[model samples]
Target chain A: MSIVRRLGLTFGLPIILLAAWWFASANSTDFFFPPLSEILTALKDEWFGPRLLADVVPSVLRLLAGYAVAVVVAVTLGVVIGTSRTVRATLEPVLEFFRAIPPPVLVPIFLLLFGIGDGMKIIVIAFGCMWPILLNTVEGVRAVDSVLSDTARTYRITGTARLRTLVLPAASPQIYAGLRQGLSVAIILMVISELFAASNGLGFAVVQAQRSFAIAETWAGMLMLGLLGFLLAMLFKLVENRQLAWYHGLRRAQRSS
Target chain B: MLDVRGIKKVYEGKGRTVEAVRDLTFTVDQGEMVCIVGPSGSGKTTLLKIMSGLLDPTAGEVLIEGKKVDGPPPGMAVVFQEYGRSLFPWMTVRENVELPLKQKKLPNARRKELVDESLSAVGLAEAHTAYPWQLSGGMQQRVAIARAVAYEPQVLLMDEPFAAVDAQTRADLEDLIRDIWHRFQVTTLFVTHDIDEAVYLGQRVLILSSSPTVVRQDLAIDLPDERDQLNTRSSPRFAELRAQVYSQIHRPKADAAEPVGAGATAVDGGASGYGAAPDLP
Candidate 1:
């Protein structure tokens, strides 16, 4: 389909749903179903107000910190494990066990150990997101073309140059996939950690609003969280595009002919 | 410029040991282009890898400019057959060519000049900013050659570099290598299974026996240096040289050196009427 029609098809359903919700909920008296207009007002006042400073900012910061930690640890460990057979074989089983456990299940353990502070929450988020990045990076590194490795050796590209120019770029496509997967996992763990025990954060605000029966405020918090996730994803995609422009170009050229 | 002294390679396969190369010894003088041709399983790659220090021989050693080669020697570059796998797909043409220059610690200005010079030599000046996968098969191979040439190695090793491309592209690449070889005055050891290519592109053609390989013949190519796709290949001397190389590659081997193991598929070809192996002395 043409790009314009494709865009229309993509956005058409969401626009229609928003229009229906606005019209249907315009005059509703239901306690649970607040009017869309009232929801928007609450979103502006609550999300765009001091609450954003007190909640959303901290939450975003925690997510970024945790995600950054996961990336660093996973990439470093992945390269080590991927390149060395002995290391991989030794740690494979234990790493698998850790990866198999769901991130949410570790929340209580972290809460007990770190005591419900930002430290505990950030650790939980990092632990949850690290597995995919680690495994994918290992896969990418192991899958690096043998010929390219030989080329590096022949060129005498030793030390940091070997890692920076040859190994990293060669495995970057798989690494990017891992990063995207880790982002979603980080976001999930972010909310779960905050929801269990947290004074501030979007998740905690939503839970607090629901408990206090401020339904419109709860909707606003949910709306803000959804938008945050969407924006973060879009931002990740932009970075991916910039970092992997050559990879995408190659894929597109391959697809075209 | 390069010497391989009594090299032997024994691969320890699962539950068996296979001798790939045996007592292979040869030399290529400075500024000479030599091609090694053999039957499919004759261990040409093993020999090249050993010579380039990518692999160690079970016995013997290689010397480049009289220096013992235990690792990739400083003044050598190799162009492998699998261009798809050899060139970094993520890097642009310029970056791929520039990689080794950077490794060599050339200043940025000098590296840029060499990259540009080599790319244009390979007719890829317009493609410096393009990725390998964005180019055609032949173009990718050109990038590989440009990379090797850009590094300005004293000895260039190419292992069946044109075996993957179509016939037409292969011809263009053969000429490209010849042009670069002449322009740079670099000693080249090119490996190929194609008899015509071996005869057409080399100053000397080294023929190897089948498995447990040994050098069977080292024939000087007496063709004029100025060669073209039409005239050089169609020359009477070209036909005779190709057939002679063809028969040596196909000659029956002793029972002990029988073609075997992984490269067995390439054992049988050139069965059509060709000259018999030159009277063995």
Candidate 2:
């Protein structure tokens, strides 16, 4: 009963919101607040047309490239810093200071260095996303169960085999937590970085349409961004479900009566 | 097969020092089954860690087959007390058992044979693919045992492996371990606080004193080689040996207060020659 009802409640809110929007704007004639039907049509034409190849593809590729770079760098450095006290002490405060400064505030600095190109925007997204992953990985690596570590040592499981089988899997739950958080930040920065600088992207498309008073296209772009966020979240969930099945099973068992 | 010569461990940290083990010295002969019994916090664990080469001693050294140990000796495996934490939660039972074998660089065929045989020995054949967290505490301990058995180490160190389970399950696991030990003929060092368990399982029981611990007594168990949960425990000889071990662990310096054969807790059959006036014999 709980499972079925909760699932029902999940889809219930989204359906209700869509229904309200469709009805409230269906009869309106305002140029700014266009009808939901017209907005949906524009969303389809704008996204599913040639504009997709130019705008959506580039935006997604930048986001993915940035996220990939962040995942690798953060996980590698996190493990190093987490395992070594000297490195952690030397670098942690600086990382904290960097993380504290809002990512959007760094756009001007990135633009100054990398120019108004894909490289600058990509680096900004990577920088914004890297912190959660790095911090969580560090905490996770440090908190690996001492007994498990001792077990590996007693078995003479050293070097890469030790890291791959023992350290990485033990720290994965926390790492995934950080990855999910970083994904959200990545998405936000993907849009924010382009808002001030980019020639093409979902954020650019929306801003450009608004300035030209193509209000329907602006709404359509907003809708597309929302869809992209939803789809990315779903994609992450799929990967996490496959990768973290054991953790999920454990959690489910823990929660079961 | 294993030798511990004057091993002492002093943990120094943050301007504080703890002498966990003090001059603990003993030798476990090849194929010997010994149990070390101590009061809680008597540093039985610290001693075991030193023997297993997981910790360096403050003074002396552990020698495995005449090789001085600085790190985990290549020929040793340990089943820790915290089964929940010791078993890798991310790995399946088979994977956990195979991990050490992979470290040994055993051929794939030999690794599979050992894992299969060891799992069956501990009755976990169907649980090959199951994660450690999915199993019951008793079963998890069995997996740990299977893992140690699969490693085929020269010396197997078990630190209160059954302490986390129910009484009935603990009894069953005790029998399982004894069976594994006999079949494999690997030297074993089992640590526990339960006197009955120590007496029932070990060929020689090493009693340990309280904090800053030392070996108090080393009593040879003189029971028959064949043992069972019911007859071996209920036998008068088992009771006498149990009484002897209990006295050694609890009343080490107070031996003159009561006859050694006087059981710590009275047995069902009283006034036996073994328990009462043995001088009449």
Considering only chain B, report the TM-score of each candidate against the true chain B.
0.90, 0.88
Tens-digit lDDT track of model 1 for B1-281: 57677799999999999999987777777798999999897899999899888999999877776678999999999999999889888788888999899888899999999999999999998998888998899999999999999998999999999999999999999999899988999999999999999998998888888778887777788899999999999999899888888777777655335333232322221221012212211
lDDT tens string, model 1, A1-257?
A: 99999999989999999899999999999999999999989999989898989999999999999999999999999999998999999999999999999989999888889998899988988999999999999999999888889989999988899899888887899999999999999998898898887999988988999999999999888888889999999999999999999888877877887
Tens digits of per-residue lDDT, candidate 2, B1-281, equal 56677788899999999988877767777798999998899899998888888888999877776677788888888999899899988889999999999989999999999999999999999999999889888999999999999999899999998888999999999999899999999999999999999999998888787767777666778788888999999999989888776666676445533322243332221122113321211
The residue ranges of model 2 lying beyond 4 angstroms of the native Cα positions read A1-7, A255-257, B252-281
- Model 2 global lDDT (CA atoms, 0 to 1): 0.87
Docking category for candidate 1?
A: medium
| True-vs-predicted CA distance for residue A60, candidate 2, Å | 0.4
Candidate lDDT (C-alpha), each? 0.87, 0.87
True lDDT of residue B167, candidate 1: 95
Looking at candidate 1, what is the lDDT of residue A91? 100
